[model samples]
Target: MGVFDSHKSFGKAILYTCSAESKDFFKVYESSDDKNVILSPLGVFTLLLLYAFGAEGQVADEIVEFLGAANKRHLTDSYRKLSRELSSMDPDLLAFSDNVYIDNQYSLNNSFILNAYSYNSEADIIDFRNPKSAAKTINEWVSTKTKGKINEIVSEDDITYDLVVGLYNVIFFKGHWAVPFDESETREHCFLTDDFQLIKKPMMHLLKSLDYFEDEGAGVRMIQLPYKESKFKMVVVLPSHLNGLSMVLRQISETGLLHYVNRMNHSEIVINLHLPRFEIKSEHDLKNILPKVGISSIFHGDAYGVVNEAPVSVDKAFQQAFVVVDEKGSTAGAATGLHITYTSLTPTIPFKVDRPFLFAILYDDIVLVAGTLSH
Candidate 1:
């Protein structure tokens, strides 16, 4: 199995919330043309699932089951509660969690699996099918919530009207580092990957000494990297000698990142921060990954359910995420929706995915703008 397959495919559970034609949900999301950091209501909702539990893998599976069989009343409440959970991130970060809002209905097409837009007029059909009013409203709120940085929200055209009904709640965000680095200080440096690959990249270096301290008691080491502007910032929390990083990520959700960020104290210590200007676009397929986590029935060849208007069913869920980090600022975009679902009941224990992994997340003040992971 691939490294992130389990983590990435967990996103497919978001599809369970809608009827059969959830592929139309993804079409609207993956089709956005804006270049700034972007996320659809579907993506945000799936991410929210990450926050409400401890065993991400199992919770993801349970979410998929709930999405498929749970009643509409439960779905409505769950959607509403998802927003409340979003507030855990930095107020600034959580603020971008709003951007688009939707409220409407449309036809449910079940023509065939793997074909979200089988009809010729689907281009116009999606524009008319405005589902998930609550989610769309929240996304729109994020745009104003984060200022112009977040930019645009998801529109109805993104969803295919072929789905009986669906809801969207998306958040888009863009922000510069709270502390900016001087151009004079920027130079080329080597970035070492986990597999021992060395890549020479335009690395930003800031050499300013400051007071530094480590407490074995706390199991964390905090370092602050400053950017040119007061709003620009980069803070790295390296674990103590014996402390594992996976432990930190498992204990800290996106909101946990913000919680620990604020606990840092400022002092006149020396800071030597070297980071690269890089861009990563990851496309995650849910086929092999979903089964490993126990939610296999939805996409398997023998799976059966009525999510769309026709007899068609989802065969797979595809997710694509793009991120760019530079001296000026950072930008990211994520698109996710459901491909399938099933029936199951189980309270998941907190499953830890810790096994020598690295994670770097972006934030504006207390808000977490983006999070990057490597294993």
Candidate 2:
């Protein structure tokens, strides 16, 4: 795919995939005891696309189908174009890194290595026998790529002998608000939790002309907040009812996030915005979750051909994400690793995010990070 090639088809496929998968993952988070959740759909999608490049037979087909791609070629081509676009952005505002770490004992196929390179991924051979050192090396790479927002994605315990190949992706974004929120305007406000309990939180206040929409059909309101000097923006989706997040999430799962975003065509209007200053850090074991979403074949010894001829299955898959939103702006980062596995608003129409809601950071139409905050 070249810069001139139309990304419409590719963008549609990825947006649907990211939206569905994010909803599923968020459900898992909701079921857990965690109060807030964050994950990068693009990071996981990129890793899986890399794995699909080396896959064959039904395994490849299943992944391609799940990703809503026409086939393996479509998957890789779309990723290449997306990678190029992200890389062309200002490094200080956004950064992305993809890598494959193989055990020194296993020799990856030359074609697979080349294909990985074409997708903007680097391949390295490391010794998994020394789990501690391997963990440190991988963590160091993740930390550097994410500008220290994500310090450690893996520990010694996460590295096992069964792990033959580890596919990793990291995305970091730090952007000042196009219209900065005045710190003096921020004050303590009441936030209603899912349990109907009121808690005090530092709320950032702003009044400006912003793109906004209210969907009576979806029972939700949305707002878009742009980042300074970048196409990236944060969209917040707040449900009318305090406990109605699940219903809104189901709507997203069905129509995709793009559907609601496209509906934000209302002209920019002046509105009051009260958004809580919050931070979220979450980690997940995807081995248990991916299968629930119809991506089961890769975990059952079907990932060998993509890396080496040795019979190996994914031993572990993990993702850790962090996001902090304050008066200045938002800084977010996430790291997704497949141990051979593989894996709003608003707005301003008095759009006060004083309750549980959904949020996403997007570049153009691509969903980078998404999560729920219900505390």
Using TM-score as the measure, which candidate wins?
Answer: 2
* lDDT per residue as tens, model 1, 206-271: 555532334466565555554443333545555543235434444342223434555665655555
How does each model score on lDDT?
0.38, 0.80
Evaluated at residue 299, the lDDT of candidate 1 is 39
**lDDT top scorer:** 2
Task: Work out the TM-score per prediction.
Answer: 0.47, 0.93
Off by over 4 Å in 2: 1-9, 21-23, 341-348
Scored against the true structure, residue 65 in model 1 reaches a CA lDDT of 53
Worst lDDT run of 10 residues, candidate 2, spans 340-349
Query: How do the residues 1-375 of candidate 2 rate in per-residue lDDT, one tens digit apiece?
Result: 323136555566566544463434555555558758887888777877887877787778877876776778877776787887787677678888888898887788778889988767878889998999999999999989888888899989888866778899989988889999999999999999978899999999999888888888779899999888567799999998878887888777777887888888557687799999999998888777777777777787465566555655566777888899998989988899888732202333688899999899888888888888899
Clashes of each: 51, 10
Per-residue lDDT of 249 in model 1: 41
